[model samples]
Target: MNPAQTTSQQPRQDSPHKRADARRNHERVFAAALEVFEEFGLQGTVPQVAERADVGKATVYRSYPTKEDLVEAVVRHRLAELDRSTAPVLAEAEPARAFETYVILLFENLARDRLLSEALAEGRSSRNTGPLLDRLAALMDQAKTAGRVRPDACPLDLRVVLCGMCLQLINFAERDPALWRRYGELTLQALRP
Candidate 1:
């Protein structure tokens, strides 16, 4: 196969030069924003993000005009990655198994980065939990229909159970991985119908 004749697979863009600079600036902002937001939260300032990215504050403002805009960008990026990873699982796996696997993957992601976990440790923020809960609740409905999960168990309750377990694991994993592991198994078994 001739390489030149294969395909021009670059992402389609409205303007090549603008896209190039936008991509670079977006990458810089994402990296810095992820770190800074995780550390300082929604209150993280534009100057801090610019310093972390090693770009001018003007660049940060160009990419995100406000702190909420920056948080939205960061959340969008991370949630996009999570969606990619879980799409196949959601589509193809058995409902109960899909839910279990989703929770496990969520725990892994939360555990991998302290800052991300900390940002979401709060019980509020429907923005953070709404998508995840909806996915799990859909799976739970399917599982109940299939007799794979307890018919009486509420999906919302299950979501809370899983979230609470994960929070405990996040808090104590460093101090006691063994204890967390034990509780993890117990929680998983409890979710089984």
Candidate 2:
């Protein structure tokens, strides 16, 4: 075979431009998957996500080989969003205010994202939550040192409390929309010294 023909038959290298395109496609698929999953929960399928993404199903599969992998990716994305949104609040000089703001932000985010609320409610282990938990622990330590949070209050306790409130808020959203803020306030009070 001619060298030119052999070169043409070989797989093309992923050049910088190709990599940029791939990254854009990956983001599109991820955004679409998050939307579909939020609307339909775990019942959403890869085909549906692909349709929403305006990309081929094979493209989605190339990035995320399985539904579970896609779900995990979406979850990680949402968790990262949560971290970004809450980080500044957690860093405030007033520890009590920081803790309150963090909890309120978390409650709002979880209430808005039904799929994430369900995933968290299921209590499944996720590597994505590690950083969020670390942040929470740091916030809790700050609050404790400032004498705003009770001495016995641990990060795990705060996690459980927040998760419990979020689960209730989600389960009763249709019945009572006001319960979310009510529960959020109650949770805040419970965390105070």
Candidate 3:
């Protein structure tokens, strides 16, 4: 067969420019979802995000099957942000100090992030919290190795404790913005060996 025939017979591939445009559309939808959700809370509709993204409603649905999925993406994004913030702390010379600082940053992000706080309250993103927990487990393992953390203080325990603390603090959002922090600090203290 001629090379031209072989090439023409093969399935066509998306051009690099088209692929990049698709990616840009996906990202635009992601950003618009977060923006709409923040402006109107998680109750914001997909159409709103489509409008904000300047894409069709089908485009948003194609990117995220449902509002929950979109919110879950945002939740993952927020946790990833928190996880990235702890990267520098992992290099601290003092293992225990690093762990404490990690917990502190976790609590700070959880306290201020309305999307995370609200999602936790509503039981969204219950399935995927890997980025944050993976980092926490690493830190815990390091601290444990140094004999600074309780042998049994696992990442799951920290997650439950933090979730509970954040959920409790959601009630105090209007009354006392700082009240939830003490619970986080107390929980951290309990985890110390």
Predictions in order: lDDT: 0.67, 0.77, 0.72
Greater-lDDT candidate between 1 and 3: 3
Clashing pairs in 3: none
TM-score of each: 0.68, 0.77, 0.66
The digit string of per-residue lDDT tens for model 3 on 20-101 reads 8889999999998777765455667999999999999998888899889898888778776766777766676477567767
Candidate 3's C-alpha lDDT? Answer: 0.72
Distance from true location, Cα of 66 in model 1, Å: 2.8
| Model 2 agreement with the true structure over 87-133: per-residue lDDT tens digits | 77666647756766776676667666777777776543467656666
* Candidate maximizing lDDT: 2
Candidate closer to the true structure by lDDT (higher is better), 1 or 2: 2
Clashing pairs in 2: none
Compute the lDDT of residue 85 as modeled in candidate 3. Answer: 76
Q: Write the per-residue lDDT of candidate 1 for residues 16-83, one digit (tens) a residue.
A: 97788878987887799988875655567888999988888888888788877787777666767788
- Weakest 10 consecutive residues of candidate 2 by summed lDDT: 173-182
Candidate 2, position 11, lDDT: 46
Once fitted onto the true fold, the runs of candidate 3 whose alpha carbons sit more than 4 angstroms away are 1-24, 38-44, 118-127, 141-156, 174-181
lDDT of 1 at 60: 87
Give the clash count for model 3. Answer: 0
Clashing pairs in 1: none
Residue 102 of model 3, lDDT score: 78
